[model samples]
Target: MNTTNLIATIALLACATGVFSHEKSPHHAPKAAPMKEQKEWGIAGDVKDVRRTIAIRMTDDMRFTPSAITVHEGETVRLRAQNKGKVLHEIVIGTQAELAQHAEMMKKFPAMEHDEPYMAHVRAGGQGDVVWHFNRPGSFDFACLIPGHYQAGMTGTITVLPRKP
Candidate 1:
């Protein structure tokens, strides 16, 4: 074969190999997200470190059962959220400002993709939980940022009290 033809054939085989490798390789699995504390929201806590567990229910009515909760500063909590509704829902914890910003973004991009440690995307009738350490003394918020969910009033509060000396 001529020099130019040889180079073209080699490039073709390289492209073919790149495309076929995925079909043969066991290493094509999706990458796992690294475990990291979301300190902007709060430190990530372990299940064993949970000082308390609170049950929260989400409904099609766009509300959370026991929509308000309190915890002492530096306390670790396991928030168990159950979706009782007939639609997909998610629980995202953040500051009220953050929630509002995210909610607005969701409204604009209803199918936006997200993966966050402080967020739990649950299917209908499914349940999930998050272990978070509220090391800061302040009020935070949790909401369902599924487009119209937040506007329909799917939000709640977390009050972190001052630590007792």
Candidate 2:
């Protein structure tokens, strides 16, 4: 092939790979900042470090079973989400302001893909989990930012009580 043809062929191949990318791969445009930075909500925890498991159910009624949860500071808990609804649902742990902002963004980009340690996208009739460490003392927010989900009141609160001195 000529030089130009060779370059064009390579470009086409690259585009084809992008089009058929794997689901777990990060392909969402305009991605968010790296999740490694610790937020006020706390950082991701290792599964082996998780001491407690909280079972949560996501229903089509735009609700999370046991929407309110409490954990002590310095504790690592496993958040297990089972999607009982016939639609996709996700749980993202963040500050109230962060959740609000993300929900607004999701409304604009309904197909935006996110795979952070603090978030879990559970499919209908499927289950997912997020292990998180509560090192901060305060209330945080978790919501399904799937366009109308958050507006329909699919949100929850996580209260991390301060550790007793």
Candidate 3:
């Protein structure tokens, strides 16, 4: 083969064997197995395991209607967020300290993008859901960590009651 053709063939072979591939390339990423992270409140739950769903409303006034929710231990609930205002809103579930820390971080980085199973971002007139299993019985906090939103009292509480004997 000519010199140019030989070089092209070698390049193709190198690429096929990943000799010139970037180790951090997205295509080379390992398959995403389901996350098994167990937070203080609970772990991520599958949709099929959802035993109940609670509808929450978000308005421009930075409030979540029926701000307090109750659930039993070992129950998987789908927390559905409905945004009725003319802006974006989100629900992030975590311990009180975690929520406060995250909200402060968001104030510094307004455009930060964090996608966790415990968070659901909903656009105006749209809806989102977070399926979570409450295995730990405790009172957790949920909030909208969108810059000034959380400071405006855009928060709620989730109470996990102990299961009946």
For lDDT, the strongest prediction is 3
The total of clashing pairs for model 1 equals: 0
lDDT of 3 by residue, 7-120 (tens): 655765676567346665667766576677999999999999997999999999999997999999999999999999999999999988888877876775577655689999
- Show pairs that collide, candidate 3: none
The candidate maximizing TM-score is: 3
TM-score of each: 0.78, 0.79, 0.81
lDDT of each: 0.84, 0.87, 0.88
The candidates, ranked best first by lDDT, are 3, 2, 1
Better of 1 and 3 by TM-score: 3
For 80-142, candidate 1 gives per-residue lDDT tens digits of 989999999989899888888778667755765556667788889999887788888888899
Clash pairs (backbone) in predicted model 2: none
Off by over 4 Å in 3: 1-34
TM-score of 3: 0.81
Q: How close is candidate 2 to the true structure, as a TM-score?
A: 0.79
Where model 2 places Cα greater than 4 Å from the true spot, the runs are 1-35
**What C-alpha lDDT does candidate 1 achieve relative to the native structure?**
0.84
lDDT of 2 by residue, 1-165 (tens): 567546645865676577578445776566565556587889888789988999999999999999999999999999999999999999999987888877876775577667788999999999999989989999898999999999999999999999999
